[model samples]
Target: MIQDMGLELIRIMGPFDANLLGRLLLTLVLSGLVGLERSGHERASGFRPHILVGIGACLVTMAGAYGFAELSSERDALRVASYVVSGIGFMGAGAILRHGTTVRGLTTAATLWGCAGIGITVAVGLGWLAIAGTLLFLFTLTVLEWFERRLNFGGPISRLRIHLRDDSRSVGKALDALVRLGVPVKRATVLPGAGTSALLDVELARTLSAEQAPLLARQLLTLKKYVVQVETAITPLDEPTTMDESDEVQKDDTIVPLNLKDATLLRDLNDPDEAVPGSQTERSR
Candidate 1:
């Protein structure tokens, strides 16, 4: 009975059976390796999703090549493989995002598409080719990233949008503050703001790191009586919004009252104990 069972096990685990299992395993490993790298960088799509995509593609390709082996020669065995290619394109498109003029997640999308191809290659019995492709992908993502940083190639750029009190002197104060912070301004534009505020659009020549950005914003806020609000992002500036001449006339009238109120508030806060024009305190002083 033991000898008979051994023979049956060998029959079931033959070369054909082993090859199918090997292809599936290889697809999982190669795709998982790519996903691991992406996960380390905290990308949108990481290990498990990539592994699933790869394994699914591999299964689809295997089904195309072997599941229909008994079909007539007139039937197309490779039709399913073609569908896999087309379907994966939509997945790639979903990974991309656009912000104003800048687009992100492009590399992640390309990596996902490559993972699918690796799976298909393994399923088609091109195991060696799949291995080589995975290695190349890792090299581009890791070694090439190091190279780019060393050479300072394509460093990140940022945009700063600032809203300030609409006084003419505020613009000069804001500019002086940025200069003291050592941020090189590539472009600066002033726009009309609501009531007694003016918008300033600034593009920096050098990129600021995540840690440095908050520090810079804090410094700008302390420019004392000049800055109202500050916003920053790792994206390029778009075209400035245009204002009408008639709108400027209305704004001037509305802004004067608001400015007077703000100035009075600042004065009282700065010198709370000082007497006003006709107070009893003023008469005593």
Candidate 2:
């Protein structure tokens, strides 16, 4: 072997070698950030699930690239990676939940699916691209919500705590009523009750007309067949705490954001929170 030092160096640097461990570690950090954002929002799937999806995709890609390298002259790593993309659809679907016309957890599912892509990028040795993608994901999750609120681009959001009888048609009837009022539901959560009742929380970007909420409460009350208690609150788009909603949600000690003070309408329709002067309020029963 008569090889010049420069030529030998070129051969060592060029043969499509991937730093497997380094890529995996980079992917781990990237995926963790995405998961952390989702967890902050109390998503159904977060942290561990995203990390698993990313690491798994990375491993699959690496296996495709190297597993068949010695066994055959032709190798197609991208084909293996394609399966990961398509197969991840099923996992993403698990994160979505539907209740009546209101759907929740779609954003969570989307992020999980995104993490899979990040993993593949890292495995392909594009660490920089993967890092960029994770940053974008975080920005969308954290900043976009604030941006939407700041611009007032979306309508105000409100939460309705509806109590219904145990009968199955209860939810359907309530949804029908809301639709008649031209209200579009964004999210609905139902919790089983102790006796012949269940609790449903309706929230969203759907705009409510003047006196519409009070009208809704009264109209739903007419459905004595199933409707029980209906309480609506104007939910504020406050900055989420580092902890999840299960923990105490703390706001800045300085002053209550006007929207947060609006939430008091749910409890005290007679007297608005004195702390927040001129705070807007919506009423429901």
Candidate 3:
């Protein structure tokens, strides 16, 4: 039985020749085009990686076709093709990223899958199909990106955290500043601060381009009379580092409001607990 199986395997991979090299080259060029486009967009995995995926997939497909076409054995070419899909899936996973709540790298993963299909088509001598497939993939990525932006399918969103002065006039001026910009704020939250610094959350009214928001932030911060800090917050939608996660200072974070006298005392003693509410009187050791 083992001898017969060996014979079947040998018969399946018949006649490897020079013509196969031409097919492989075609696959490489086509795959490279796809990879090049991705690279232009500044993705993590770009041209070379995409080309390799396409080439590898093509080789696998060639193996499958030859095994079934020549050997007339029990092996299923379709089954082999399915394996290529699963294999490329793993490669695609490498491109994906999951942070706090947002997922990126979807486009990169999709391109990998496309390159695999092109490879398989080329391996089978279906050059036109492979070329067409690649063109379609490129159009979807490039053209669709622009179309989506024009339609505002996924508009820009920004999170702004502002520290305003404690006076009512300052708060009014801050609101007026936002009103002038015509920014449609989605949500706003108030952060309680000490005597002078009051925290405020100001969500954008509408999505602004990445550049527009920062320039606007610098303008807002310029109002020195009542404005202390105007920071553009990085939302949890993007993966945040450990240090990025800070307890939104509720009323509990401070022992008491920081004052000039408290600053002087803390500066004098290494440990200033003697002056704290619950501490005992300091004694000479």
What would the TM-scores of all predictions be? 0.53, 0.68, 0.53
State the lDDT of candidate 1 residue by residue for 151-176, as single tens digits.
54446556687778767777767776
Best by TM-score: 2
lDDT of each: 0.72, 0.72, 0.68
Candidate 2 yields a Cα-based lDDT of 0.72
Clashing pairs in 1: none
> Where is the poorest 10-residue window by lDDT in model 3?
240-249
lDDT of 2 at 163: 82
Off by over 4 Å in 1: 1-16, 74-78, 154-285
| TM-score, prediction 2 | 0.68
Candidate 1 — worst ten consecutive residues by lDDT sum?
243-252
Query: What is the per-residue lDDT of model 2 for residues 1-285, given as tens digits with 9 covering 90 to 100?
Result: 457876898765545544888899888899989998888887869888999999999989878876676678776789999999999999999888876666778889899899999999999888999999998898988899778765555566766778887778778777766665555677777788658688877775554433455545654555666777777654454331122112333333343212222332323222223444444532321
Best of the two (1, 2) by TM-score: 2
**Worst ten in a row by lDDT for model 2:** 239-248
* Model 3 vs. true fold: TM: 0.53
Cα lDDT, model 3, residue 154: 46
**Error in Å for residue 259 of model 3:** 30
- Judged by lDDT relative to the true structure, which candidate is superior, 1 or 3? 1
